[model samples]
Target: MITVVTNVDLFSTFQHVLQPLTLKPLQVVLAYSGGLDSHVLLHLLARYQHLYPQHAYLAVHVHHGLSDNADAWLGHCQQTAAALGINFIAEKVVLNVGRRESLEAQARTARYQAIAKHLNNGSLLLLGQHLDDQLETFLLQLKRGAGVKGLSAMAAQMPFSLQENCLIVRPLLTHPQQMLVDYASQAQLSWVEDESNNDQSYDRNFLRHQIIPSLKLRWPGIAHAVHRSAELCAEQQALADEIAEIDVVTCAHSFSGLNIAGLAKLSKIRRNNVMRFWLAAQYLPMPSRHHLDKVWLEVVNAADDANPQLRWQAGEFRRYQGVLYNQQQYAALKDVVITLEHTLSQRITLPDNIGTLHLQDLIQDTIHNKSGVDSSNAIGDNDSGCCVKAPLAHDKVTIRFRGEGTCHPVGRSGSRSIKKLYQEYQVAPWLRDRIPLIYYGEALVCAVGLWVCKGYEAQAGLYWHVTRER
Candidate 1:
């Protein structure tokens, strides 16, 4: 039932929703769009702040620049925030209109990204999505044949995507749009109306203008019914997530991948559920049903000797030696050779996020220490078993990603191919080229973090270490 909200009832509703949150004296940011719903929320927050002045309050407006009147709307938001005695910030974001996703989605992503920049950990962000907006989202997800997670619709409160411990809260989610309108009318609020809202080209606008009004007329309590359904879906999804978490703990491999053998023991339904949960944990986009099926049939169930992979837009799933790995798509590393100065102690930054190589000139340090050991003797000896040798003064020391000939490592007796060594070391195939190969002129010295070539073992001079980027 749509309750007619007076000023007192509206304030009571706001207090009832916020009281349970038990919010500390944190930064409270309101997403004020200068629209009716947000304007009503802004008024209620101003009143709430007046009563409880412990929390810091601010209003932020995201200007998408999609509408010609966007500048005017921003001005209205600024003026209204100032009148309410709240700090205000306006962020302008560029939208990728030509992208495959709808313009509405692009605008929303850009807006949230802009807002996320202003928030710190544990900040509270308030949105103005009411029950009517929730209904629209639920209907749209249904149209797309969504599962429980999608059908759960917009959550009343959720963790902010960009910041840990930050929350995105919609206090007005349980109230219908009529309540907001009634409150705004009673409060004599003024707000800007975006012209784009009337355009039926957008799916949301079409639903708001045509579909929902008729539905409300036919079934007076449809909004509450849809809201109940969404809440039920959210509850069911939470239960499924719990089961997936327990399954993940059992099937997790040592290398941060899933164990296919362990997964095979579970039923197909449970396996699929666990796979989705695993992908989400890796922060990869959820794959389509077809792609998920391909992961099971082609990657997980492939012949033991044959490598199998299933790729999607954001990432890929690959099976290697009974383990399933989820990897985000990375750009191919170029064959770039970098020269290093052996005379000085320095750090070299590698390309393609491989991290840095630190070279310490032990001989230089020993000379500075005025030690009894002769520097010449240290340079001449080649039996220290260190991963890197002190290079000759005229030797062109360089680093490369690829190696040519076979190498006899310091601990190993015989020579072997680089590929064979990597296999012996159990290195994944995709990471083979990313390993930095140290070289003195054309002779391979060491594959960092792996092994040093027997001929290039250091006697007592330079030492090298590799630190990978997180």
Candidate 2:
């Protein structure tokens, strides 16, 4: 039975839902879209704010620019918020329609990313997702053959972003959409109707308009039942996550890398669970079952000496030295040579998002009196503290990603090829070309953070440092 809600009952329910959250007087931001659901929520929040004036209220509208009336909708939201005496902020986002994902998915992602900017560490973001929305989401995930985590649907309350410490709360999640309509009608509220909502081309609209209405006619309590099932799935997912957490600790290596040996000890199902959890921790997109199987059969199970890699749209998985590493696909740097003049202190920005290079004059007091020491016989220091002799006025100094010939680094005996030096220093094969190499004309002088050339070592002169962007 769908019971009509009075204005007083709606406000009271809103207050009851948010009572626990008001203890700290946190900023409450409503994702206001000037639609029926959000307008009702904003009206209720305005009434609640009158009683609990300690908590700050803000209405944020994300302009996706997808609809023709997007600007008009923004104006309506601004006017409504001003009348309600709540702070208002509007953000415009550009959607990448060319991506492989659906337009609906792109819009939702852009909306949240735009809204996430205004949220502080402890801010509360209120969404207007009601029971009907939850039902549609549940059915959509079910149609996709989702697992427990996906079938759980939208959470009523969850951390928006762990790094931001922001909480997203849906106060109206338990309430029916009809109840919101009733409250809005009784309150004499005016809200905009999005034409896109009636477009049956979208999956959610098809479910909402054609499929769900019949389902409700057959089973009036279908929303409640679906909500209950989603809640059960959420509970089961929480338990699975707890198990994954324990397994991840045992399998993880160096921060982002996973030890293949430790992973091989687990069963196939448990191993996949750990992989999903590990990828989530790295903020990488979850791979499909086919892709995940490829990761296991092709990458992790590859021969110890074979270099295997798997690339996806968001990120890639690479196996090196018996460890699986999830890494972003960085574009290959071009052979762009950058000239560095003799300056006391200078910072050079590398292309292709490589990072900045800092060059500063070494203090004279830090230099050891090596006049008695033979310069050619001195070994070069491979540590970051290593400094190079300042280039002469006629010296053509440059920075390059490609280097050749032999380099005798400090603290190392004799000279070795650049490739040999890379292997000896344990530099990853993928990162060897990315390391900035300092050159005096054609001769390699310093490998930035790796080592300074033996004869070019300065007792007190310019020091080179490279800071990676990623």
Candidate 3:
């Protein structure tokens, strides 16, 4: 068994993956579950630790807090790590297995989140999934009727920006489960067995126990053949990615929305492909086939003046003001206001959603300060002299919402309605009400985020400063 392990040194195989990615001074974090496969990996890693002193490594076991033996298993992992002279980290995570989300998806999400927290740039998270597991994943993708990218299954070395600079390397992807088990038995390695593996409740387990066995007996090389199919899918995906990059460059607009005319110019097949590719790039989940088909029809077939709107769990897409806008729900804010006295500066923390402000100039001394400066001492002859000085008075500050307001910008005496001002500015109707208008009691001093009221406009030889949290 030692000879077999020596001959198939997983460490050296991993090295080739690392050098190309420059994933070194390597910090290899194995997602150790105390199960047979990961246990074998931990054992192998410990064996080669001395040879790779420059590489930092650890065994991370995520205790899902699901199974009853979770505590015991965590303890076992700690003991094993201590005995083997390798560092061990255990994360106790709450699993949110909802009715809509499967046990497999929930567990994978929680486990990856836990591991990701520990990884920094240039580090790698290793999973114990072998060739058989890859074969199962490929079959599952087919069951869902996934596209080429999904059928590509897992990559040998995946670089994830979990932190500023990090990469995840799966060295065991090419190795078969049988080979790992054989090596473990030959070397007399002890590992915990998860009873869930035998539970047919899980789809992957059902496939492994019932479907794969029958298929393998008939084909004898089903796993290897399916694995090859996944590789071919991955190669096709590379070509698709190149083409998608070209499409993205052509159709993407200034506001990160799609250019409707440019998109319409593409061939129907390419349009659909590029739309799916664009949504996926934005981390938006794909809609159903029928929904996508509808989307294409609404965008391409509809009259130019037709108002097109579509929604999905990920987000909504609407054709408005000549641009295709993909939108998400924004955080809302409480209506509040703070009033600042003339010649006084104030620092105000804004609510999550209330950011913009509508304003009116009230007094001759009132000044609008757009200077990006924090509250400071008021110098009588300093810039922002028309507004309050820094070290603002505490008592008079107040916050209020924009209701009816009117203001004449500098060089103009006639007041324009706040509603008309916003329209002229082209502020989206969805965003206009959310902008907070700052008031010093009854008087509007400055807008929380947007322009300060023209009356309170900061000017040279004036003594006022305004501070806001971005």
Most lDDT-accurate candidate: 2
**In model 2, what is the error at residue 423, expressed in angstroms?**
5.8
C-alpha RMSD of each candidate structure in angstroms: 8.8, 8.4, 8.7
Q: Residues 299-415, candidate 1: write the lDDT tens digits.
A: 888887887877778667888767888765555664788887544666788887666776666666676864433445544332321335677878898888877779998778899
Q: What's the CA error at residue 359 for candidate 1, in Å?
A: 19
The list of candidate 2 runs beyond 4 A from truth reads 1-8, 331-427, 431-470
Q: lDDT of model 3 at residue 113?
A: 84
Give the distance in Å from residue 55's predicted Cα in candidate 3 to where it truly belongs. 2.9
For candidate 2, write residues 113-227 as lDDT tens digits. 8888888778988999999999999999999878888889989899876326788889888888998888988878899899999999999999999999999999999999999
- Residue pairs clashing in model 1 are none
Residue 227 of model 1, lDDT score: 94
Clashes of each: 0, 4, 33
Compute each candidate's TM-score over C-alphas.
0.74, 0.74, 0.72
What TM-score would you give candidate 3 relative to the actual structure? Answer: 0.72
Cα RMSD, model 2: 8.4
Better of 1 and 3 by lDDT: 1
- Report lDDT (Cα) of residue 345, candidate 1: 66
